[model samples]
Target: MSSHSHDPHILCPHCDLLVTLPTLKYGQKANCPRCKSTLTMRWQEPRRRPVGYALSALFMLILANMFSFVNMNVKGLTSEITLIQIPKVLVADNYASMASLFMVVVQLIPAFCMLAIIMLCLPVRLPGRWNIRIAWILFHLKAWCMVEIFLAGVLVSFVKLIAYGEVGIGTSFIPYVLFCLLQVRAFQCTDRLWLWQQVSPAPAIHQPLKVGQSGLSQGLRSCECCMAILPVKQQVCSRCGSKGHARKKHSLQWTMALLVTSVMLYIPANLLPIMITQALGTKFTSTIMAGVVLLWGEGSYPIAMVIFIASIMVPSLKMLAIAWLCWDAKSSKKVDRERLHVVYEMVEFVGRWSMIDVFVIAVLSALVRMGQLMSIYPDIGALLFALVVILTMFAANTFDPRLIWDRSGTFENKEKFDDGQ
Candidate 1:
């Protein structure tokens, strides 16, 4: 670890420790001594790796859209769905909001982020302002682009359709899968601090903040987007131009509103049918719990367990956890802030998977059209379920994790923060 007497100082986002950040050689990473969160890391061939991967991702994304995604054959009737059609189905069904959300997560956001990475990599020609804009955009967009998770849901839906007829993996499936991997790798290759250094070469480094004080009394505040330390009065980061804050304003109110909205939507998300399947004029509608029960009865123990956890257990538990955190907002050092922080991380990590049922419905609705022989359409509950997932996601995001450590006085002083003295 670098020492404040010699190296740059940064506040750890996870634990709020003001520690000296170590500069690393290629392939080396620095972790926060206090909380074990990775501080910064340098990659071997950092310049080429992300650029190569971004180009590859773009290629794979093109291929993913160019060819058919999947083909289903029932009797002499065959139905094929392309990657582009996933969002189109929702739009055709008058679910414009869901369509837009699906498009952004699976398609638009990934493309934009990868392109942004590419632009950021070529910082020599781009203006510093545009570089910051692109990097900042990538920072926020990466969380919502969930091609990998969507692929898992698609695979599960594909398996469920095998009993109906022959399901043929299309030319795009492999590329799309590979694209997801490449895109993820490309993102991992991104080093925000390193990128900032590239753009500016000499960023304004700050001394460790005076701690053991409340509010903005301390001179140093960390940028949530880049972890760059800045003067307390600076509204925008010099390095990333991201807005700085001593504390997220109205965090409790925003979280409470989102959490309550999630609870309100959860009822229909479980009670009403999300997917209505019509086979040979026989209609079968399955709610979240009903689907779980049916899957268990059909002996698909693993899938049933997964659906039960992602759809039912995860959302319910997440709301409870958020509510607990909100109710106990101002944590104390006497209490377990570490455990509380871990809970917040876990909630954010598992929040997105709750959309499994929604994605599965989308795939089923698109690929199972048999001209009335068999057809699956997303139901009212599908929209409501999607709302539930979105609300929970917002609930988690709006609830600032830093609030848990605020009253705890986690950052006592620089001397104590250094590897806990």
Candidate 2:
């Protein structure tokens, strides 16, 4: 083995002193010597954006919920549907179990989780009593926020759904697309790791005392720009060719725009039909809710239940949660942090599976093709429906759980200082 590898004490990046660490794990972190700065040589800290982005995301969410997704016309029957009616149809058709589960995972859970994050991150002082609860909510929301993954699933399902059904794209799809983008931006803005740092009190800064030159030294320095060891000869960073380094500053406007676009899209997305179907020369169109009714009427209770949960319950809950977060942030009211965290976790965990209904449609379309006499074709509604799912997923992804602790603004200042140092 190399001597460097065998040595128990590894040279500090900042100060040249060899320091021993506890057993090193994959994500283990250490501190710098000269400045006592926290360091993660092998691991990288999570990146996040500012609070404005979170608010914008809220707007996009609303747009996504309000639009039509799909429309269908066949023979003498024509119908239009919005995105909300899907799950109800599934549940009414005797698919209650799947519907209920889908509701919690895809819509209700994620919506609440997003709401918890917004509530926590708002620029208001949280009541000490509610801090614990808020922390818990943050923890849970982190796990439940799986909007991106859900979007991928929805897209794949849409491709297949169009194959067997007459599908039409709706107006809501534009906003839905925007919503996804905003969600990504929001996630970028808010980071859980950063939130943890804020919620947890900082450790006392200790200055090392001068000691004999016994292989340990204080006040050692390294190139801040390049992170290279120096022998007191170099003034500029050799690797990066920089004389100094500074912490990166985030662009508030860009992040804000992202959120704003997402919110704007939410409006039309909810208003439009998500799917349109024509069977046996009879044409039918259904929004998320109408689909549930149709399924219930047909005695497909199981399918109706699935649709109800995935399309209705989940999205509605998410809207409420986000609204609550916005309100809490503005009002600075104390919230149940732990509960909110749990809500967020549930949202992320279940968000992706909402595409199960879409998946079923895809499978059916792919396998059941009979040319003009019995062919399934996708319409604008499927596109819009797909957009709603994708946008919501993005919304979940964009929202950051750590905004809760940002009220004090100390974390931001500290980050700036660390970058400068």
Candidate 3:
């Protein structure tokens, strides 16, 4: 039984096991013994590494926006689209929502995240609790930074365009790719635990904690935003001022509601045309599956599979997985807790990739305009499909993975389960 204001002990966010963090050397990491979640890692020169990568990433992003991203040649008529023009073209086509999505996920979010990492890691003096506010926004927005996914979408779009004309990478293409890599590396180097610790030391634990047991049993919980371990009864985090629960309150109900709404949107997203092609006075509307089939039939096997997996298979299976997780969390039947935990992690990891199709549409619509000879325009279905992806992502976030380990017969303390802590 011991306590410290800056405690070395941590509660695993996934399984809630309390463990003492060891002094990790360079390139070493600590994992939770219970559910195999990576708790923390010690990177080589964490401060300098993230700051450098973020700075480079921001520079690359600037270059990406300044020049052409891709060029298409058809019958000696050429069209080139810049990275910044993607959203503007979508807006011109009257698809404001899809345009906003593209702008936010592809550019704004990644840029902000990189800047946040730089500010936090560097010795910058911000005025009046700005650090805490920035840190909060940084961690929350980190998951939504989809630059890498957008890059993948761009590659798929290029492959799809190979049949229509000679598709070539433009001046901005390599810079954007480098931007994606640098931003991801910068994010990986900036650890949430480390950042929160910089903002404020972790709150003290006044009670005894068992190393190999659940935090709930010890009346403790981890803040989702800052990873600060605190008493279960404390609703707001003392360190980061974030409101949290031992588990997400009514997590199942909220997740189920979002899942239901997303499922409804998914039906129309599949049925309606996502893209419109205008060529030689003929307009052709294509649904998601139709596009995939066209790509496959045209011998673009890899790109077709990528589209099918990202747009169709991933969303459908993710919804089913979320529903199954809710069931497992609620039911009293003996469930494989570890396997369920793995499934929840996978759902979180793959949920955002579903937006790749929406990005592909943006790229195609922006680059393939030839004034009625050949042009691509986004349809209503693209907006609906984007909404579906966002709704599912929110569903995944609202779901509390810790609940999967909270069922009866899993933990040693039966009273904790009965009390519903």
Candidate 4:
């Protein structure tokens, strides 16, 4: 009698081996059987119609900037203001510094970045230098756009404005909301990794051994200098002195340092007011938690839940996960590698959504400027809040999740290849 086992159904891209597909839930992933290369079966591809949506969004963004965001009336005084009016008001009011910062970060930069992305994805030919520059601009812009943060700010301001006096939604507000959604849709459509792939030069491919006694019939030939490799398994090459393939591990100390810093910042981020409002020469500051409480008390349960999740829960969870992973790495703990990887993935996935609070603040500040009647301004806490979210996100990205498996020694020697099984 022969003993038999079921074969996996996964196809490894690195080794071109069809292996068993691990039982994965919707968001789960698996590793290759032969090459040990990780595979994500649940990865989402950009939608096909995102380009169309992006174009529509671009139009809406232009319209939103042109029209007024809010129309407010207080005690027989009425004023209508557009989204672009905010910067003009700031500049005219001699708050040049704030105005410049606001224009660049909140308005000009985001608009140009979105426009650049549209240009890059458009079916048009641009000069190589300009194309490359725009591509780089888009890369940086993707991180700084902060549309979600803007949305959150808008909602918060709306609530505050409605609480005090009459507040009417302007034409610009509708388009601005659509613009945010459009930007998200555009991003989902245009795959950043794929765009990067397109702009990057293709790897130079060399002809494989035709009939020579090259003694190179198995593995890959990789450039040690650049790690450029043909996917096949090869022993040694005369050109590059690279041995078996091994990924560089992230420094444990650096990861731990970042995790510690994230933990330290987490306290102040929750405790300190993320936004302060000044009304009638009196200032009111509200921490992240306070804001949640305020919203909950106001019967805005849905928005409160959103704020609780995005601002409070997600950031705290991300920091803890990073810290745990780093601790495991430092202590050389043999924890569940797959589970650890999943946690890391979850952190990365939710990191950006943490900007929801920031978005709310921005939108609110822009919309609820009613002169002496009602003025909305960002508090010092917003800066710290943004910093906490950004720093934690960076920490999550910097700390390699592979360290979890490396410390566990669960990874087999990747260089070992059998000639005859």
Candidate 5:
């Protein structure tokens, strides 16, 4: 474990355990002993990480958004789908919320992240406060930007549409693909802690606390905003200044509310048509499962499986997992604390990708709008599905995984066992 004079301790974001970081080689991750989340990651040439790639990605993003994404020609009637027009067309079709989210995830967020990276990586000094805000914003933004998943959705939509009409790849398609790849590579190569160290040279240490004494009894608590270890007596985080929470401030209630909303939307999301296709004055509607079945029938088994797993299985699993965690943490006695923490992390991470189907419909709906001969429109289920994805995401975020460990009694005894007998 490495400790400097400036900063001697770090808090586990998952389990709220104070830890001293151990040095690791490039590509190695230091896992928290309690909940097993990656605490520290070492990547090569941290100073250069994601910078060159971000610049390249920025260029690719500009090209990708500036030109049409795809061209669809049906019975001599041609329709071109531009990246800019996708959101415009969506709003025109009264899917304004969907349109806004689509643009934010696919374009605005990624662009902002790329720009933030470039700014952070430049050989220049920036104001520490702005840098911290940018870094914090980029961290959250990464989860919301689903360009890779959106690309997968587009490919699935392409396979479905190619059966009906001629679909031409556009000039921007290659760059968009490259953008996803490089964007992912950039993040893979960047170390978040490394970035933080660079941006904020000064670090404040959290007051130590005996783990066994928790709740209102002990001053120890995890900062909800920055995940920093803080004394409960302190109202604001020494790091992020978010109001300190002895507990997550009604974590269970907010989680349950979001989960309930997801439940209400889930049935409609599955049963209603996700998209409507009108061709030669004939309208056809396809629900989530219907689309999956269509792909299966068309011999696109891989794509079908991807859609079913992403659209059906993933969300189902996330909802069940979150509900199970909540139930077990709040009431059950024999629940494995480590397993619950892992499940909570998985649930939080996986919920964002449910937008895959929504993005697919948006892309297809934007690209294939031909007035009389052919057009595609997102259906009611698409909105509900989008809501389901969104609600679940918020549900996961509202949940505090540390509560699981606290309920497990591990915290109540850690101090007694701190030393080897």
Candidate 6:
């Protein structure tokens, strides 16, 4: 209940509530009273912790690229693949879309995010604009880094390969696993507010702010790029120069547009073959459902369920959820907004996981290359499916969760409060 006028204030990104931040002890966090979105966190030794973890993660990432990732022996014929070779094989097979997706999500994004963390957390000085640019890119790209998802895909690939022949761990496997863990830890340690404060100071607010009030009512808005609180009239943030509106303009329109596109792409993605396998001079095409059925028929129920959930259920349900949210936000009828907010959070968290199936295909296509005995190649459906996942993720990003709360009468009334109130 630190309501002192001198305390720093922030507009909650979730519900646009302007909240006064209290001094937090180590390992403490502050959440918005209205929507419960985490406002800020106080980590112990934030700078040193992220730097160490990022440095270790970078070293592990380098090691992961230098050696064999997985080795398999099929009827005395052996095949091994390196971490870097996955994309190379896809490119060689002319599936550059899958290759680029694999490389960007698994390797490049993670590496760049870790490097950015180290640079921002360390005492090294750069131009203010450069620091802001790097920080802006870092936050935006961090969610897309899927090293952990790739690791999960690799594990699922191993289960599928166990039925084929003997599979063994490679020298690089441990390092890659370590890299995933360290990179995630590094990201967790790097607080968003702390990094922004270090790179550029928050803009001064001359007006009085009260906790538990909506920023929209106070004529204030938060910059999505840097979390800087600014007057609603200011369309551009002074800190990062990212243009924003009180709410994302036409958010529902953009979300529905992307959702419609995803549904259209999802049809082809399901009907067409996702992977082509050549075995014993016979070619077999597997669609998404066909692959799941084959895995189940092979007695790999858990792995089959994993694919079924990640590829099938997640994308379908996520789209439905987005459509429902858009409708709920538009309708005048009262709904449990808190529950909807929870659903929104879940949607955001699970959207990226839909990429797991694509990554699994990339792994299989790269490692199961034993000439005619066994080989897997990406088909058109893999690309289509990948696009569906990306589109749905974009849809989720465009739909502002704050809109769910904007219809509340409380915020509407606050809009009329006096400036000195």
Cα lDDT of candidate 3 equals 0.88
How do these models rank on TM-score, best leading?
3, 6, 1, 5, 4, 2
Q: Report lDDT (Cα) of residue 163, candidate 2.
A: 36
Worst 10 residues of 6 by lDDT: 412-421
User: What residue runs in model 1 are displaced by over 4 Å at the alpha carbon?
Assistant: 1-7, 201-217, 331-333, 410-421
Instruction: Write down the worst ten-residue block by lDDT for model 5.
Output: 412-421
The deviation in Å at residue 363 for candidate 2 is 12
The sequence of per-residue lDDT tens digits that candidate 3 reaches over residues 1-421 is: 4445356778889888777777777877777767778888778887899999999999999999999999999989999989878999988988888888889988998999888888988877699888888999999998889998998998998898888899999999999999999998998878778778877788877777777678888788999999988899999999888998999998999999999999999999999999999988999999999999999999998889989999999999999999999888888888888888999999999999999999999999999999877999999899999999999999999999888876532344322211110
Looking at model 1, how many pairs of residues clash? 0
lDDT (Cα atoms) of all candidates against the true structure: 0.79, 0.46, 0.88, 0.59, 0.78, 0.89
Candidate 4 per-residue lDDT over residues 1-421, each given as its tens digit: 2221222222233333333344455434555543344544332433335456667778887898887787766666666777777656655545455456556656677677767766766656686556556766665556656655656656665665566667787878888888888878776556443343344432433444221111123233322222233444443422233343322235556666776786777777777776666667777887878888888888888878888898888988888888887777677545666677678778877887787676566555655565666566666566667677777877875675544544332224433322321
Report the C-alpha lDDT of model 2 over 1-421, residue by residue, as the tens digit.
2322222233333223334433434344444333343444222332223344455555665766687755543343434444454455445544444345445654565556555556656645577635435645555455445445445544544443443455554665565566556655655445443343344322221333222111123333333322333333344443333343221123223333433554555455445554445456765555556657766776666656766787667765764564444344445666664456556556655655555555444323332334344433333444444445555555555444333322322111122212221
lDDT of 5 by residue, 300-389 (tens): 999899889889999999999889877876895777677677788788777777788998899899988888778889988999998999
Candidate 1, residues 1-421, lDDT tens digits: the string is 3332323666767666666665566777776654566777778877789999999999999999998999999987999999999888878878777788788888999999989888878746575477777777788777788888789889778667776788888999999999999999998988877776665543465443443343344656767776666677787887777786766778899999999988998987788888888998789888878877877887778888988898899999999999998987853435677787788888989999988888888888888878679998888998998898888898898887767766655454445422221
Candidate 5 TM-score over all chains jointly: 0.89
Candidate 3 deviation (Cα RMSD): 4.2
Most accurate candidate by lDDT: 6
TM-score of each: 0.91, 0.40, 0.95, 0.67, 0.89, 0.95
Model 2 spans > 4 angstroms off: 1-50, 73-79, 202-421
Model 6: pairs clashing at backbone N, Cα or C within 3 Å: none
Residue 360 CA error for candidate 5 (Å)? 1.3
- Model 6, span 1-421: residue lDDT tens: 4433333777889998776677777887877767777778888998999999999999999999999999999999999999999999999999987898898999999999999999999978896578888998999998799998889988888998999999988999999999999999999879898888888777776677765677788888999988888889999998888999999999999999999999999999999999999999999999999989989999999999999999999999999999999999999999999899998999999989988888888999999999999999999999999999999999999999889998784543322212110
Q: Of the pair 4 and 6, which is ahead by lDDT?
A: 6
Cα lDDT, model 5, residue 225: 43
